[model samples]
Target: MPRSKRDKKVSLTKTDRKGLAWKQRIIDDIRFCVEKYPNIFVFQVQNMRNNLLKDLRQEWKKNSRFIFGKNRIMQIGLGRTKAEETETDLHKLSKRLTGQVGLLFTEKTKKEVLEWAENYWAVEYARSGFVATKTVTLPAGPLEEFTHSMEPHLRSLGLPTKLEKGVVTIYSDYTVCEEGKVLTPEQARILKLLGDPMAKFRLTMKCSWTKKDGFELHVEDSVDDNQSDSAMEEEPEDDDEKEEMEGDDE
Candidate 1:
């Protein structure tokens, strides 16, 4: 008698197995970097901008390495306890790897790295959920910067705009958004169109782990390890962040 088709076992696809393989690859890479580099720094990113970060990575590609995402996987590679640690005092560095943080492995001196981080920052267009830094108001009359076709779009964003002759115009002074309020999608898009950037991307050095001296605290730990892991892959920070092999960046 022939067996039923439902009795046949389905084979797992590459994608089904990718999660474990990806995690293992990241773990191995972290451990490998630990051996290759003498200094490892824990850093937190504020207002992360993917383009700006990619550019910074390209600039530092020659000497430094950055490992981001999967904080737990990184912790496993670095070791979470004294016995499991890859190196002496590495577990301490792993302990502080909570929140939106990444590892920087480099050969640069502590002073040099710290000084560079102090001055490194980029102004970027704010995305949805960010708080408006300042109030924006468009005065009554023709808005020459915008074309007549954009009048509909501006009005849709709650700008109260119309086309006067061939130009987008506002009959009365229009307030786009108020300061200190969380920005909606429309407000963010409008701000971007108006060339107003409210987000600043900056890196803050949290702590450092060195080969000779072991772990040294640069900034006091403010984040809780037990904090909700729901934001581990922060949605608002970078929409396109993904895993890449050492020489191949995304």
Candidate 2:
């Protein structure tokens, strides 16, 4: 007889079963996170998982949560009804999670979390000593608006900027300032500040005004009532001086 078909089937060993169980446990943890947090960010990284985790724990211990897991498991977790039914969205987002993904969660506002991410990117870029990405020029109007929008936030970080020939330039002696462009130093510093630079800029621009009606105006320099009285008192002294002068002449 030929080799039995049952002999051809590969059975899962005890170790394989145990590994499967551990993976399931991690999936459960991910599901719990999806249900618990409202805002989630998916990050794509390469060869820096351990370092990223360390940096996150050290820098954002109080406000951040991180999880790494299989994309399918994460998508299923995101779909859970206990959460907001984000399965479809997760599926779309999972495309970028192929290489190595580290999900970031925060109890802080979304703005704060994104700001932190931007700062992290800045540090990472500095460590590599190069631009990890290329720049694309936006339309002129939008670029102008964006520059104006970020001005005050830069100012708050003490990184004043000026518009020169349609380019935003940072003002600092320690860092090289170039005409017709915002420099890398300025961009890095702005990211390090970790807030909506545009929002702060808008607020600062709005603050450049006072009420036109002058409701609270006050004057401090009024003539004193004692001025006439002092002049009257001086008249007698002047007459006495005049009489002395006449006597001296006589």
Candidate 3:
């Protein structure tokens, strides 16, 4: 039997489906963090190393939480222009999440986090096309580690090499790269071959936010390293003296 028009259910239209489902999920995640942690920090990374990051998560599992991926969604979750949306100061962190940045919700104080970021470092092979931080020079001597067959490949990297009785020998000191110079394919390959790792992995506490401090950016400024930049300007004092007396005493 056909139902009456008033009895029919209202169907959702395209406008109802305008937003992705995950956006709400991200918002909920951000809200949960606000309820759970006292302070939050943001970190920007030059590259991603899954194993190392996983280890860090395990180590800080007791006191910290790491949120990565879907940065834009998370940014919107925190609030963009105003704090009224989230009803918290989390919005202040949105501006600094422009690049590959992640959220760190932690019970630990800001000083502890910043110290770890400044001191904790890892060394890894420098990728091709990155600038060489230092010069890689191979002295004129017998390269007993490499066989004679590798002579051609070594010379291809611009090293003056010759095979002497089935051994690769460098005729003179060969400079593979210069400091502050963009490394070429050959230079990177030779550096790795020589087991000279130049790249140092480091993290910076780009910024942080909290209830008492509001928002702070860890930039080089007049403030000392021991101080946090989150202190906002003092709010106007309430002129209660000019107001008429009201309710009863407690």
Candidate 4:
């Protein structure tokens, strides 16, 4: 009994296949950077913002390259062990790629990169669940800043806001957020409306690898030697770990 053409099932899972291709492309690109650039620095981003990073990439497009992707894929790119590492002591650098980090392959000197990163930071709105940096209290009074129509939306966000005499007003002293506290969705929204941003997107230099210096840790506690040294298994891409190729040759 031959199955009918319409009865045959077609596989729907191409995510894994696409992820592998993306990973391999990253690995190849990393290796290529190793050949093209003389130095590589692994840096951690405090608050990830694609727009800020994209701007930096454009500015350094000629002299530097940045790669942001899954840690496991990046580890495989530079190799996870001495025997497999693409460059000398890069395995040590690979171990430090443990958090929300990215690689900067560049021709710039180590001092230049360190100085730039130390002073570079951007302030942006904090999202829900972010720890508040400072307490923001709105005194009970007319919120003349907002339009009367915005009273309902403000009230829905847990604000004691109302329309009074064609003005939005708060009945009582409202604490939008408190320092050392995790923000709720409503609190975060209110803070944004009030133009109070809590998140500081900054890059901290973790470590750097060069042919002359090998692996050097710029920041203390960048990588724990006691942590697992086992090679990271290959992982499929997700929304967070999507491929980011900036200033790559390709």
Candidate 5:
């Protein structure tokens, strides 16, 4: 039996409607995020966006899912629920979020995200020649021990430090190893490549067995007074004629 034309048309319309509804549901989810999350950080990748997109695509390929949605839709989606409670005021965050944005929805920890941000900023800082204004305090310890532990790593990175007022101060210009000592362009490049001066120093000390190397050797344990005396006694007698001739020449 042949189906009626009206029945076929009605069935096709129902299928089309269902498809459109599903599409709208996804878009609404994205819109909620954009509207509610005032702290949405818009990283302006610009030229680098393609690289990020490629990485995301690769990850999606492996995981069989990815999120690439319209900003407006995400803004609306964020407003649907309180994604994360914040101590910062919403007004301040809203001002910061007014621009292009790419959403990153992940299960990764905040620390992991912060670490990635730090590494990214490190590269940016190197290219722009920027230094952090923050200073970290170190606990009390032996000056010689501290210097020995840190100096080699700093030297390797071409960054110089000095013990001033019982604290290690990094030179104003990272290009120089000693304070007020100008560094060549190559030195600055090396220092930039070495990121985080303190981390590098700690790693170097641990790898190089600096603690053992820095331990002081006692004179009594290392050498005998009798041996020293015998060695001193073996010194040759001064040739008086030769000494007089040398003195006259001088």
Candidate 6:
């Protein structure tokens, strides 16, 4: 059904403002990095944690700048289409902007960047409703983390619990989650409470560019070139990308 005149006006006004602001921000970000940094890299991230990314930024802050934004804006920053716009042939790097991508601006050499990838990773706790990567079992024992008052709550979640000598004790071993299965809400909460981390942080270098060289591509053994290299093959190369990768960027 078509919208009434009033509804259309309200929707258009609110959406247009946000859309324009986002585009302008992308343009400014790309321009700033291109003007200041000598090298540009397009990298992919998986299962990334915001705190971890911030830590990485701090680690490389003295020499590098990182931007995770609209891919087109990032592409434009590296001179996506108009080669003459940027000092370097950043347009070439735009071809590999696939998946959860971000740009790294730095004077660091390609070798240094690749070397850093070797050790750049972190592990984090998984949230509820996420699929378990591995089986998680809470063996029958006294759950010291839980107070005696939690015994009743734990029992409601299917854990056979009882208070024993002021400690929350389990009556039998319980399988909290199975590998490749969606984690129950209770399981996720318990895992977090147990301080178990299941999320692995990782980054990948898809391609890099410099003023002298157009783009130097790096392929990881685990990635399939046909698929990985062609992630944006079907995505339109214009400034009018309709959707953006969001939520968990990895």
Per-prediction TM-score, please? 0.82, 0.37, 0.66, 0.85, 0.27, 0.71
Please list the residue runs of candidate 1 whose C-alpha ends up more than 4 Å from where it truly belongs after superposition: 1-18, 222-250
| Full ranking by lDDT | 4, 1, 6, 3, 2, 5
Q: Candidate 2 lDDT, tens digit per residue, 193-249?
A: 432122110000000001121111111223232343223221112211110000000
| Candidate 4 lDDT trough over 10 residues, lowest sum | 230-239
Supply the global lDDT for candidate 1.
0.80
The 10-residue segment of model 5 with minimum total lDDT is: 201-210
* lDDT digits (tens) for residues 82-194 of candidate 4: 77887778888788877688899999999899999999999999989899989999999999989988989999999998888899999999888899999999998998899
Better of 1 and 6 by TM-score: 1
- The whole-model C-alpha lDDT of candidate 3 against the native structure comes to 0.69
lDDT of 5 by residue, 1-250 (tens): 9887777434555455324464466455434433432222223232223334545446534212223333333333333122321222221222222223334333333344345544542122122222332342323333343444565565565445665665555545442333333434444454444442411100000000011132121112322222322242221322111100000000
Report the Cα lDDT for candidate 4. 0.84
Clash statistics: count for each candidate: 0, 0, 0, 0, 17, 1
Best candidate according to lDDT = 4
Off by over 4 Å in 2: 1-18, 46-49, 80-90, 122-250
RMSD of each: 6.8, 34.1, 15.5, 5.2, 34.4, 7.6
Please report the TM-score between candidate 5 and the true structure.
Answer: 0.27
* Positional deviation of residue 1's Cα in model 2 after best superposition, in angstroms: 44
Per-model lDDT: 0.80, 0.40, 0.69, 0.84, 0.32, 0.70
Which tens-of-lDDT digit does each residue in 1-250 have in candidate 1? 9998889776666347448777898888888889988899998888876566677777787888888756777788998767788798787788787767888888888889999999988899998999889998889988898878888888998887877678888889988789999999999999999999988999999999989888888897664444433433322423225333242322
TM-score of 4: 0.85
TM-score of 3: 0.66
Candidate numbers, best TM-score first, in rank order: 4, 1, 6, 3, 2, 5
